[model samples]
Target: MNPGVHAGTRGTPLTPTGLSRPSVRSAGLLLGLALLAAATALSLSVGTRHIPLDQVWSALVAPSGTESDGIVRELRLPRTLIGIAVGAALGLGGAVMQTLTRNPLADPGLLGVNAGASAAVVTAIGVLGITSFTGYLWFALAGAALAATAVHALGGARSATPVRLALAGTAVNAALFGYVNGLQLGNLNTLDEMRHWSVGTLARRDPALLLTVAPLLVAGALLALALARPLGALALGEDQARALGTDLRRTRVLAVLALTLLCGGATAVCGPIGFVGLMIPHAARAFCGPDPRWLFPFCALYAPVLLLVSDVIGRIVVPPSEIEVGTVTAFLGGLLFVHLVRRRKVARL
Candidate 1:
């Protein structure tokens, strides 16, 4: 049986079997929100020096000139906020990619978006002598936009087939990675700065840094949310969507623009964190079926859960010297991906 085919031909919304119950969806959303809150609290409290919940509350409510105040206000607070934003961006980006390509395994990292941004940053550092991340941010966004345009062009945007897009992304990703590696190898200065930024982490981020990329991330997120219905309409196939008056060209352009902003902004702030996007969207599908509208909300809530939990785990797993959040998420997400594959739960729309 063709997994993509179904009995309905009216372009009506389709939910995965046994998962369309409204009560179930409501419960799932509530549970996801609760878990997100818990994770946010955990992120604020648990670290190298674990702060008690009461102290955490006090630090949040009113700083009292204590050591906990400094740690809470200065360090963990910004890191937690950034983690939430980055995680949400990755999750939404992943959802968008999977929906756009109708591919179960699509992600920004795998699609060369992250590599393109990273390469641009490296180039800025090496050739342009851009010393600060603020300078790197503009270059990263441009690189991501260019890479996305290239991918669509190579993939035959007029047709916009899944296999062609994936192949083009793979080829572009490899080429960009080669350039990044070449730059790193040739310049010791580039290597030193690039190595640290390349390992995705939420540490040492200032509240001011969050302000830098917030507008882009917010814009991308709002665009994604607004396009939820059109994305769902896409599941009915291109011909059906066109018959229903969906503009395929406009949709593709908008989706690409939204993805560039989200992926580019996140990478600019926290490096190229992988798997969050790939893992969360599939999980969202399992919870709320394949409706992009439903899936995105869950993705927004649960992705931060995964990211914050992974960061907390990273803090304690190795004690004094903490492992990066990216490493922890990669380890966990890889295991989840393997498990999902084993169970045959991952499928294209």
Candidate 2:
């Protein structure tokens, strides 16, 4: 065993390098906060118009009806705020999902949350003639909850293992997404409306929309944080966690609920932005080890950094046209996922 690495649950060397110490974990968390701040600043400053940092700050603090102020207050601020919220939700959700499944590669989507949200959104636009974000938000949440609940039932609620849950979720995801695709293909109007949204960009999100979903996301975040200890115990294996008095069924149920709230709200707002939930946990693990106590907070803070930075990149990559943030993350995350698989042995939880 390397001196710098510490054994985690099941004697796995989960901590990389010198991050095993509490002080180091705290420092890493602070660093994540700094990165988030920088990402927020960049999201505000770097856009098609390229407002200076000072001007961005000025616009935020004191709006003077200038073009910059209008752009900052009306446009970038909402986008940035939504980005932060969505990013945090995805990141925290991913971490919890991965921990619950004991699979480092697992993401929130593995539970059918994204697919469920997408199917509902497609239905909203195609069948219900609902085009507004606010109108479809509740439908998205209901769909996600139903899908996850069905997954749990299929997985045998009481006897559900990680593998069983994953398989059930995959089945549900396939079915729902297939339905979504067919509906979209059959209706050009629905397809046109969904084209931009399905690609997952944070552009033109209303602040009021964020406010509407804020409570749900915040509740989900709190629930995820609360599950850290139980998840950590579960990572040690079911028998061990049970021996330690952890109620596996209750924990799993709550975890699913938390994920539904987190991923559901995020998908409702941003239309299934990929890779933040998939990638941020892995990055946070390298710095905070496998302990959900540390990893969750790190993911919560730094995930927004990845999301906001990607949004900024999207804005500048194609002049005025700009790539969608989801497109950028998918491209980057695909490469990173490949690298993670090929470069090192996948960590076992």
Candidate 3:
């Protein structure tokens, strides 16, 4: 039986023989919740003003007339929620892309999505004079579609094996970023649009901002859920998946669409926050084994947790003057990424 076909007495994929494996998912859920709670507390308590943890909880649960409550509820909460949304999307997106492309190293950063979104947004800012993020989603989605198409053209139908996929994505990423850098250098309006956005912030102007992006995120997520079984089929190799009645073209299109929905909208909202997608899935697959059915939902929970923690770290680590999430995530993710590289181990996505 295929690895996608999990431990089932009746030979179905992903369903174990009854509820015997409860402890595995239970442990994962507990760990994810613990991370989320810790990150939330840290977010509430460790800002420049340094409210106590209890006060942080109070400010959250009991938003009364207190000054600290106002500070915590109004200023900090929205940012935290945005981080959750962005982080979860990236995490899940990265995992699915890797699975679909069969590349453990593939990420929006490694791939063309981030660069495409950046280029599209820059174009909107520089040539079109559109400065609002709400107005930028269409461009971001267009860029991501173009980048993915370029990857398909460059990689060809047979070249989506892990090594080749990453190589193609890297080449595309470098070229696109190069173009974006030139635009930023030559155009003041582009520079203005990207300068703050490039830094990556959770502190959005409105909680309503999240509502705007939520549909894309939710759509991406549901599509990923639908694609998981087919992806598992593909993970066995294209020839095998085809033998199993999985349509490779359909799977690829769905994966690309899901990625565009998730990453494009995310970049439109929060700039190119890198590696949440790359690293979170790597971590998830490390624990959950080879099934995307396992990896997908796990990422849904864990990615937001990672982002919220990272965002919280940025808030408190520097006191009054906080670091941007992109820089913080880059530095931290860079170190972990390097460690993974040094190990030279690719966990099967």
Candidate 4:
């Protein structure tokens, strides 16, 4: 197996660690789920108003039309749920993109997904006068799909290599981002909306929009999970995959479709929150190894932990005002990436 791409955390468990591979993976998975649950509680309880655990629980079990119930049921509940959904989507999307591209640094944004979404949102606000989250959602998905399709076409379709695909995506990302900048500069209203959305906050979210995108994330997640075996086979190299009777074309197409749906839906809802996808897979690999079957589940559980922790931290770090989840994750994930590079765990792709 290619250690860099296919096998992370490669080693036999030592007695000193008090765990075998299966045990370690199981522990990690359990811990991740527990953390997610705790974070969800914290998210519901520790917002600007600071509803107590008891109050949050009361609001959940029995709604009395009180202020606490409104905060718990109407406001924080949706935000927390959206955070979980978006976090899971981004984490899985990043893992899928990196494995398919064989690039440890590959993130959902690397494929122009975020840029395309941004361009669409900016265009909608500026040209179409659409100023609602619901309006942005559909536009973002369409743009992301179009951008991914363009990248695949430019990368040579069935013959595209991961390097070529990445390069094409980078080019498309730059062009779309440039176009987004032009749109923002030309319109004051667009600039204001873009500035807020670009920072990526789960605040002021439309529950309906979140509900609308949930199916896309679910579909994409199922597709990504289904491709685990194919991706594992592909990690062995194209010739080896072909020799093993894997269909490379089918795999790539489905993989791209998965990324587009996951990343697009996430961007549409959360406005391009960064780093959840970039950091979760590598972290999961460090604990459980590089098998996608294990990695995907770990990511699905652990990513919401990271996100909710960040969201909670963002709420508390500044008191009256809060930091954006995107900013917090970007800083933390960038630091991790740098540490990995300095440790030589990540090589040039």
Candidate 5:
């Protein structure tokens, strides 16, 4: 089914809309891909030195007399690719979490997954002297898992509720942030070393980090995709879902774990990126129609495109010293969040 003409609520068609479903979805996907391609070109062509678009394209595809090709292929390609991956993870995870928890505001970072990962990395660095990004990937994953567990524990029971889940998430976020700060305090060296990593930056990432982290993030996203039907069933309320053979507990566990892998690995590699999760889902909804399957994949693509473009913009706007990617994303994500809260359009999700 082309999805551009009809709306599917939980693996079932809910209604037929005015527009052609296939055409609408196709247009959205086409637009996303076009933007991504343009963003990739812009990222390659617009750097410190004014490399002509033709030269950049030629160099990127096949090396030439000068080092331009090598620079484009070697340095910028990896960074741009990693941005796409990380952005996808954040966006996909955000879409999944929002659907899973049935709350428009839910995001991996907002619900403290990134904070948990950050805290874990801090613990590792402070106590174990673990500085290698590859080595600490597990630390981040474990921290995210623990933090996720804490949130669920506080909100998972029948006595517990989704609103409580969010509150628990917020409390955990604050407490973990404070603890990380406390550990950083009274030790200038620790603070100095962790400052860049803690501030949600893509400062200096290992090319290998993407390779190491991609599998986990991709797997988590796949699992989240699998939960789409059950999640939509649960969305009508747990009782309705149970009547529909949806296992609410299992779905929640799986979704949270997916979030752990995506947010944790991304945070470990490039610090805690925020708003990609919170904002991308809303964007995804405009096309995907609240179905996680469509929303999930689209978010993955759009997230990276948005983030990389933001990073590229940062590079171009400020001469030699580039603005951090997280800084640019946060400013935009924060603004959207405020509007989302007030507009009632975004809040319905």
Candidate 6:
């Protein structure tokens, strides 16, 4: 057996032309980028009014102040940009999370991060009467950090297994979301404000909100990328990872911090879009063979493709009315979840 080659579930070396070969992985990355570009174009062009690609390009380059220009520039462009940023954050966060936990089912939401953010945002709206995205952003970050910390403590940080952490996260997720529901049910204003947000649409978000959250997303992305090598080492097993000079404590700490920033910022701006994190990493692993270096970038590119395509579909699926992107993803992710549960080979990390 070659020390350089990682083995898949059946002990097959994961270096075939279709798998972990550097050339093939690089080509896959390019293909992902191409797909993302097409998704972005479709997102801009396939909205309620169905603007043409020429007009979309013109709106970007030279705006004539037409309704099409308003739709393209004011609405779709910001939505597309937010989708890209949030999708990349969720994708990279999910890859890091699954690697850190050594769990195939790990995602940002699995650890209660999204629930914490939602609960905090609801608190801000209902209790504090804070209506600004910036305010929600701060509360969301705080809640995510607190929830992750609680999960770490409850899971027995020094001796936590993947199962223990997952159980702890599940407990915390249920509790926080229950609290969120209670607040929404008690306050009509909160419920009204959270109606669309809870469903997770990319519509009606202010462009300024993107500017506010950009730094957090970039920082989280950089941190997640930097953890790739250490996380890959950790994936080999804790004893082996320690032998290879991986700092388990520091790695876990940074990974959690990165998850908080990425998940919190995304939930803040877009209101907790699901399944992008869960599905994209698995899809990337199919092509990249679980190497975090390749897997992270591939997830980043392809997650937005899934998200934007879902948003476009949500727009056109019904007549003038549209479904939320979250609803679309939830339906799709539910199918994928069923398939994963039935297929043992794909479900193991």
lDDT of 2: 0.89
Question: What stretches of model 2 exceed 4 Å from their correct place?
Answer: 1-20, 340-349
Determine which window of 10 residues in candidate 2 has minimal summed lDDT: 11-20
Q: What local lDDT does model 4 show for residue 278?
A: 89
Global CA lDDT of candidate 3, please? 0.78
Query: What tens digits encode model 1's per-residue C-alpha lDDT throughout 132-177?
Result: 7677778888888889888888888877676887899999999999
Shift in Å, residue 265, candidate 3: 1.5
* lDDT of every predicted structure (CA atoms): 0.85, 0.89, 0.78, 0.88, 0.78, 0.85
| Tens digit per residue, CA lDDT, model 5, 44-124 | 777676667898878866677688877677778778778877888888888877887788878887568887887888888
Q: Which structure is stronger by lDDT: 3 or 4?
A: 4
lDDT of model 2 at position 168: 96
How much is the lDDT of residue 11 in candidate 5?
44
RMSD of 3: 4.9
As a whole number from 0 to 100, the lDDT of residue 120 in candidate 6 is: 87
List the lowest-lDDT window of 10 residues for candidate 4.
1-10
Clashes of 4: 0
Ranked by lDDT, the better of candidates 4 and 5 is 4
Report model 2's TM-score to 2 decimal places. Answer: 0.93
lDDT of 5: 0.78
lDDT of 6 by residue, 190-267 (tens): 998877677787887888888988998999999999999999999999899999999988888788889888888888
Model 3 bad stretches (over 4 Å):
1-22, 153-171, 338-349
The estimated TM-scores of all candidates read 0.91, 0.93, 0.85, 0.93, 0.88, 0.90
Q: Model 2 over residues 74-97: C-alpha lDDT tens digits? A: 899999999999999999999999
lDDT of 3 by residue, 1-349 (tens): 5544366445423534333244456677788878877887777676778899888888778768799998888888887778778887888888888898787767766558888888888888888988876777678778877886676567664445545656777888899989999989998778987786677777664677678879988999899889999999998998999999998877876787788788877876788887788878867765577798888888878888777777777877878777888888878887877777667654345
Q: List clashing residue pairs in candidate 6.
A: none
